[model samples]
Target chain A: MALTLMKGSEAIAEAAIRAGCRYFFGYPITPQTEIPEYMSERMPEIGGCFLQAESEVGAINMVYGAAGTGERVLTSSSSPGVSLKQEGISYIAGAKLPCVIMNVMRGGPGLGSIQAGQADYFQATKGGGHGDYHLVVFAPASVQEAIDIMSVAFDTADKYQCPVMIVADGMICQMMEPVELPEMKEYKVDLEKKPWAANGHGFSKKSGRSIINSMYINTEDLTVHNQNLQAIYREIEANEVRFEAYNMENAEIIVTAFGTVARIAKSAIDDLKEEGINVGLFRPITLWPFPYKELHDAAVAPGVKAVLDVELNAGQMLEDVKLAVNGDTKVDLLSRLGSQMPTPEEIKEKLLSMREVL
Target chain B: MKEVIVLIGNYGSGKTELALNFAFRAARQGKKVELLDLDMVNTYFRLTDRANLVKSHEIRLVSPNFVHSSVETLSLPAEVASAFALDWDTVIFDVGGDPAGATALGRYKEDFDALPEGSLTVLNVVNTRRPMAGTPAKLVRLMRDMGRPSRQAVSGFINNTNLARLARPEDLRYGYEVIREASIASGVPVLYTTGRPDLLETFLSEGHDPAFIGEPMAIETFMHRDWETFTKEGL
Candidate 1:
């Protein structure tokens, strides 16, 4: 219960430690390297294992190894590094491993820049790695949200026995902010209860079988497995649609955004609200099973004219907004691509321009 | 015409190591080689610091201004494009990890495509530990998902585990087999095997350096060889 000024990436790393994450693996990359660097410096003090792997690939595999042991494990990387991490992420999902993966996105089609951008939204929520599986993804807009959602990310991963991703971008990772640490609680990880984990040689001998965390199985078995996965996904959809609304009452417009962009939108909303434009914000905390119903309601809300979806990419989130809004509300996009982050003033200007079009 | 072979791979799979060694080998052969470091993905492992040594050997060192910058294409200011348009014997573009980081290649695909038969070569580093580091099945699936089919690309894989700890030349050898197997299974060629230049020197001097030899082998041929035979015979 202490307040500290920290970068979003540093806060996430500290929160992971407090949340009982004792194993960390990561490769250093810009904007998000602080997470790994911080873990490398401090993980040893808590008798934790921190391995800065040969590359993002090795780091992710190390995570896979730790997760297999039912230990609290985490990995962090930026856009390019995250791209390298996709393969491991997919395998973790197929195996239904419990772990935390963080992507501090930067601008780019190729090593875009060290600057912030939201280009990886589609990649993160849609499953960056290959497969029919989803990682419970949390999009944090501030340092505090980074800590809070990361705490929830661990719980959700354990609850679902799936990998959870904390998708932040360069801005959130690099910017320093005031974070009031949450009340400390002893971290309790119950990997022993899960019959699936590879705890040690003794567990395997006692069980009289080697546990395999693979999706590949006989045709009938594979089908059953997939169906079960579907059930889990449905449960998540029903139970995990989380979002925050600001100034929705009597608002004529809903500014739909997430992560760092959403925070910027909130400031712009305040400015526009004072100007009597009645603009509100819908920031989705869980972007994976995107708060579709929340989006639908915002679009159909009384006096809502249009939903202005702003982002750091060239309209990646626009399509989702359109789908969720379902043509009832006019969907407009304000975007920038490749390392360019749109500011609050620019976003407000776009919102006003969208009103004119409406 | 001067040819440029760009080495592309995920981080820590040894792009910098391969590119550096390849540049030296090509230079020794009297080929006017220019090794360009477009590796903007990693903050370290840049070859720009050694550019003077490379230049002293009469080998051209063409790169963007920010050699230390991660994300080659985006950080290597636009001026580097003119360098690409030039006539060089070998131009190696050490791309960053992931296809998104290869965005610079988006424009040059056509240019490289126009190269006289067997001009452009893309060497992909494969490490068994990373995300796509799984079996060949996973690599194919990932390539397909990323929309970069290996069928047409002159893609070959070199297995290299650049891990500082628990990494020996043996780890590199294991990497070679995994990557070779995946390349063969995916219908890409096992163009070469990579290791630290010192370890690979004997093969390099014997003209057996698989890294520089232009081969037209496809993924099918790569996969056709028996796993045991290839491992023993050096795939």
Candidate 2:
């Protein structure tokens, strides 16, 4: 496919459509509003449903209802909106339903600024809602990666029968970059084929009724369900941990970042390389099943001095990096709080300053 | 030769993309280019987002002070006033999308009026796919709406009909016919039509008029959402 420039949020919506996601429910939010806007225009033409719900809470519940029918469903929102959908997301996860949710994060603790920030790292990776559930989180650095990740997000969701979250920042949601879109997949919505789907199959001798509910009244049943959820999370952590290491071998300082911040860190690494400073970059593609083993291996590699966690928020992902390094090396943070972004030069200067400690 | 070009269009008419491409094209042709990003409406996908890229191509970019800044204010920077006084071979104003967006251009009405009579050209960009300019009458109405507020006459129209990477020769033809009708109704000439470089040959082979086509300018869709592609691999 030829490369065409696209905004990250719009591309993700188009990719979901190509992946045969026929049901979309979302509300308007800055930075990520284009996703719903694009879906509203394209969904009806493709024989799919696009609905602008009254609120993020309503939108996520709609997704929950749609995914219960075994249909590929998608919902997108920004940080505050994502918070509103937490109850629905937790319910969807508890029901063991498959759906794709996108959180194009903005600066937030409350109703924060409408700019890029990685403060949601802990919220996304460490269950946002009250539960022992873990969502498979994918963080894309570029528009192309956003497309590719979204193309498979539905499949990943269906394979595990769990909700998958594509965690991106406002920068990725707003920036335009060249991307090659994926081919449209053939999707058929046949309720009869999915026996587990709650598509009005009445309780009879031949057909068994399927119930979709998150309320496990029995304590023992809920405990076992929690155990099963943990097993799934363990499997995801074991098999689906993805990360990209750039110039990690023979590195003095290893910088860790994810999503758009990782791309900026890569640029900083390149500039430092030109100046004869050996700085490597470790980008976690899957935020929730984070590349812990890989990051630890890289941090413990010979001649590795310190690991810097560059982020748009003040030290949210630094804890994860420190956990991965496990005292083998000092894991510090260089961040811009409240939606501010660190430029390549600023990151390079921080990396240079860490040389004395190394 | 036109020294000043002002682009006005409905929302999603590809006006900003066209303005950016035109600035780079003029610079590549050895003309000193100055691009004024007069888009104060939409925060994202503005010319200021590509300021460094435009600067790299030697095109001077004049944008609001808060562009790409954390301030998020809509106040225009003082540099925009100096843009009119600066001497450059080509000065392009990338007006914001929609009639309301064109109101920002009113601040520089006197500077634009003081230019040589034929040197300043206001081009209304049209795409048939956009709701505001889907028909000839709607296109004309959009032109008048934008022209009145900006205090600039719409001298010509640029047919930028496209569906991102899915643009077919037939799509361009459909857009051209709509633009043709719009031109006759509004009495404004069709300056040129833009499309992918690869599709231009197909447009000509399909018997599109060379007169209305003008020189085949290779216009790329730089402002697109992420899942939109230009390749025919799947189709």
User: Which stretches of model 1 miss by more than 4 angstroms?
Assistant: A183-192, A201-210, B1-235
Candidate 1 per-residue lDDT, tens place, A203-321, comes to: 54345543646656688987888788889999999998889988999888899898878877887888888888889899888887888878898889889998888888888878878
lDDT of model 2, residue A337: 90
CA RMSD per model (angstroms): 18.5, 7.1
Q: Determine which window of 10 residues in candidate 1 chain B has minimal summed lDDT.
A: B217-226
How displaced is residue B177 in candidate 1, in Å? Answer: 59
Best by lDDT: 2
Residues B131-209 of candidate 1 have per-residue lDDT tens digits of: 2344666565544432362223545666554333223444445455555556666777666655545544433454433
Residue B11 alpha-carbon offset, candidate 1, angstroms:
27
What does candidate 2's lDDT look like per residue over A189-211, in tens digits? Answer: 55544556875643452255688
Candidate 1 CA-lDDT value:
0.71
Worst 10 residues of 2 chain A by lDDT: A199-208
lDDT per residue as tens, model 2, B65-103: 777654556688888876678778899989888776899
Q: Which stretches of model 2 miss by more than 4 angstroms?
A: A189-194, A201-207, B1-6, B10-14, B17-41, B45-95, B98-122, B126-156, B159-189, B193-208, B215-235
